[model samples]
Target: MRDLPDPGPWDEPEQAPPWRPEHGEKPRYRYWPQGHRPALQALVDGRWRTLQVHSRIDYPDGRVAYQGEIELPVEGRPAEHHHRAYWWPQPGRLRVAYGTDIAPT
Candidate 1:
């Protein structure tokens, strides 16, 4: 019979587990209205991180009218991707803009 390898520290379950806020935490920058969308923020290793930005529009019947997502890069210079629903009404099509001196990847 073959001997099984032992699991490392990560393989063990949490004793106390992590704490998650009930009403969610605050963000560094201004966020959109709650009815408009969902936003997230976090601090890792003392550095601020913007996790996600999501939003939706609802119809009178309580159906999803529109949806959008904004994703950020994981490392190095920050990058963002903006995606939105095709049916939402807006002026001038959505445009992608990067910070000053940053080139699109």
Candidate 2:
């Protein structure tokens, strides 16, 4: 309707609720059974490394919301980066939702 304001980003329907974590499941690796290629990469210092990925959830048409980690050498010490990634074919592509370096648990 002409009276309706144009929808900005938040108009999409919400995704289904994610499953509850198992007891003591502090670190979980949820994943799809199949995905082609290592769909994302990051350049660290002077080198590149393929990220290790797993999905917390996915839709039937290949839309996935995932989390993963990468091992990086920071100032000669070992570190891990926790990241969230998403795959959406429409206006969105495979990309990092957000990420941060985290201490090992």
Candidate 3:
């Protein structure tokens, strides 16, 4: 019988979302789970804006959260906005749609 070698940091994801200078160390990159392509939206400037999900987090409190970027028309060269949202059933300033349950803009 052969002994298996220890896997260092095997829990880490193979790929991670791009790191932005604005994003501090605490909110590290997390992998978005497969087959869980839920469109996320956040209330921005009094309107719901769709987010380009970069990372997904499953909190210890049984709440799922998403962090991503959104492009909005701002008076600047870069109009990309960063935001986070929790999955539906968790009261938040965001909305989530799964499968064919998409909502109109």
Candidate 4:
């Protein structure tokens, strides 16, 4: 069969840069409900093509930041948590690693 001449809506969008895991783990921020939380950052989002992997974000100081944080307040408490997650892109899907000795929930 011959290849199609002009592609239509099938055109793909700009792909996101691949994430580099630090010591075999990506640096991401996670959150918890508190009281029973992880030692480090809590879980938010770590899948491929996710908004959490934004390239550049505008900072309050008129500076572009490559990273940002997401958090939520705990119920009936005046505390909250932020977390970072690690991810790996695979064929047609993505892989996530919480951290050393830590598994994805």
Candidate 5:
């Protein structure tokens, strides 16, 4: 019978094999929530301004949440300022109010 091919270095028992064990693990954050609506209102010197408000929300762990930049215009300034805030559903309602100003920027 024909001689079979040698197993080579891989067949050596003294050498350790290059293999990694599998460990199925889950991620730390969960899926984001739905039906999240955010509204913004601007004011200057205790008076409400005409500028509109914009916001975004991200839920990481179901209970814990994160929010992004909120942009709004001041009374006199031509540019918009961006602010960030976070909220907890279990706690009471949180509102951010501002006063009016005469100067812009």
Candidate 6:
């Protein structure tokens, strides 16, 4: 198991305002609709590879982010690569704890 490191500072504010969450669990902003699978590019094994979006989380303050895991090659074998995935549709960039910024393909 390859555990990726924790993500760094988010490009946008991660926390929703106190009054926001009280309204409901639904995100105020909808960049990518729920159940939509978006493909993004990330740096894996020193090369850019396409990764599929597994799930998404929306903040009450209208912020949305995507996350998922990808299989990576390690020592000539495929290994589960877990990364702290955070997708910001506004910037059209995906940031992972693996030390690179992923972008929409």
lDDT of 1: 0.31
Report the backbone clash tally of model 1.
Answer: 0
Candidates' C-alpha lDDT: 0.31, 0.40, 0.47, 0.30, 0.30, 0.45
lDDT of 3 by residue, 1-105 (tens): 222222122221112233345444434336545444456665555666677665666544444556555555455466655443334343355666443333212
Q: Which of candidates 3 and 6 is the stronger one according to TM-score?
A: 3
Q: Write the per-residue lDDT of candidate 4 for residues 1-105, one digit (tens) a residue.
A: 322222222222222233444324443433333232323222223322322322233323333223223244445776343322222222333222132333222
Worst 10 residues of 4 by lDDT: 7-16
**Maximum-TM-score candidate:** 3
Number of clashes in model 3?
Answer: 0
**TM-score to true structure, per model:** 0.21, 0.32, 0.44, 0.19, 0.24, 0.40
Cα lDDT of model 1 by residue, 14-102, tens digit? 11111135423421222345444343332223333332334333433333323334343445656555342322232232222211232
lDDT of 1 at 3: 27
Worst 10 residues of 2 by lDDT: 7-16
Q: Which lDDT tens digits does candidate 5 get at residues 1-105?
A: 322233232211111111123322321332223333333333333333232223232233343332333334445767464433333331223233432222111
What are the runs in model 4 whose C-alpha is more than 4 Å off? 1-67, 78-81, 88-105
Candidate that scores best on lDDT: 3
**Which residue window of length 10 is worst by lDDT in model 3?**
7-16
lDDT of 5 at 21: 35
User: On TM-score, who's better, 5 or 6?
Assistant: 6
Error of 4 at 13 (Å): 24
Query: How many collisions per candidate?
Result: 0, 0, 0, 10, 10, 0
RMSD of candidates 1 onward, in order: 17.6, 13.5, 14.3, 17.0, 24.5, 9.9
lDDT of 6 at 23: 61
* Candidates arranged by lDDT, highest first: 3, 6, 2, 1, 5, 4
